[model samples]
Target: MGKLVFLSGAGLSAPSGLSTFRDNDGLWEQYDLDIVCNYQTWIKNFNLVHEFYNKRRLELRKVTPNKMHEKIAEISKRFEVINFTQNVDDLLERAGCENVIHLHGKLLELHCTNCNDITKLNLNDDLEFKFENCKKCQSKLIKPSVVFFGEQAPFYTDLYSTFYNLNEDDLVVIIGTSGAVININYLLRFAKSKNILINLEKNKYINEALFSHIIYKSCDECIDELEQIIQEWNS
Candidate 1:
């Protein structure tokens, strides 16, 4: 099978109208990253944490999948595509792509922190902020199962193993995410050690040695080029 794995970041969704996790000002707008996203913050201020996520969930409803998303979905038809995205939006799935792995967590699914029971939520403009209670235990429900800062990333071992075991000829695409966080820098190194082709957007601080080709463009533009490259390779 043609192996092509894509690791997408916030940049991939920007064209779709979703705001990046960090704005140009280096904050998620009004909220400090540590005070609202860390484990201590969640334990100290559950209500505030819930409110922050609820706001993000509401925003997710307003965005639509961009051309880049569509192109990725279309490319998957001819290749064994594995999309591991940091984005919580459902755009990739909406674009008809399968085998998507969400590293951060999805915005549409809610989970009871007490019971760990996950359920899909329907979002609308009229959506009210009602704290859902777990049916089994009657405990307060939290937002979807996601890995916040200071929390160990869920399924780290599984993801590592999956990528490590892939054939040497497999292609790995990294988009929009920074060189750090979610252990992406480590994964990039691993891919490089094996001489796998790594593609990513040109970021100044990112170690240039890790990537085979650095596309100096946004994710939307990169996807357009990627689609063309894949088509030519297949032909």
Candidate 2:
């Protein structure tokens, strides 16, 4: 009957053979961010945009859910859990969590850039989503469902409403993300009575005083500690 909100980020998916932009030699290092990840680039050259996301989608296909995902799935059973993820991967849903709120659009979906008509990725015999011209619109503009650099997340209004509507009794658990999309200051200001932060390493953006509990440990270690805490509370 209680509620818990999990605000997760790229870090949640990193342990599962995924990488974040901040990691050394990570995905961002290999490409021009402005050209592949920006809305302006999509306008000027859709091919570049397609090329980048195709590689990302292929990379996603090779990975599997890790301990972090399994642990979070276990947490889901104990509370009325609402997951807000900045990650595009479906690993959480794959791990048995449901109704995940993807702050960033997903990699496995496609859309008509002109009409906002979204669809699942269209894969060919090679197991890749083909980005051809948009069939739904005569304009023939098609794009990945992801939120480009200059675009507003489609669900910002819903996310903001959830933040403000949090009851004082609700527990908020934030994992992995650096709070880039939603700043740390704003989260601290709008947080319900209790908040927990779990990250593999220290983020310079975090103020230790703001979190009820600040956990800095490896993914496996964090999972173990969290499970133990949950057990104790249940007992």
Candidate 3:
């Protein structure tokens, strides 16, 4: 059976009241990437970085999945689907979408540098507001399970493997990403399948020519159309 591969970014989660990084009033404007998101400065500015992601984790807990997320979850039940997301948020998983491949990583998880063990953060409890010692290794060197600006993304190999194996009969749908970090133009070169892009506006970083279809609209606004396409393809 042909698979539907959803390559999503911050725009996919924008409707859930999350801030995107590339927009005019995005999070990048509020926080300095050099201090909070750079790997080189992370160790020195550990407190600042931990505080930054802690706040985001709390924010993530408060917001619920929007229509697009729910729609993707519903579609997955009847069709072969795989999600490769640049966004670290768990909105997709919370919406019941399975087979999600987080290229950047997850927000509600911590990685211990000492033991390399990943621990799921408990948002139900009062957040400590500090990077607590890893339970497995008792080391204070725990960072959010996210790829920093200069850090290598270990999950990219999974994404590459998935893309490398895609056949011409498959479908690639990209949503709400500017392609500044993950090169959408380059990655799609491996997909010899139908490519679709859904976004509110044109992205200069993306090579529009590569896409077979493009929709300039909010993800929620295009859900009905997207669902119809997916349903038809699955049938």
lDDT of 1 at 178: 72
RMSD of each candidate? 3.0, 2.3, 1.9
Q: What is the lDDT of candidate 1?
A: 0.69
* Model 3: lDDT to the true structure: 0.83
TM-score of 1: 0.85
Model 3: pairs clashing at backbone N, Cα or C within 3 Å: none
Off by over 4 Å in 1: 24-27, 124-129, 141-143, 183-185, 192-201, 232-235
lDDT of 2 by residue, 33-130 (tens): 87877886676877777777878887877788888888888789777788889999888888899888899889888788688887775333243546
Error of 2 at 35 (Å): 1.0
TM-score of each: 0.85, 0.90, 0.92
Error of 1 at 7 (Å): 0.5
The candidate maximizing TM-score is 3
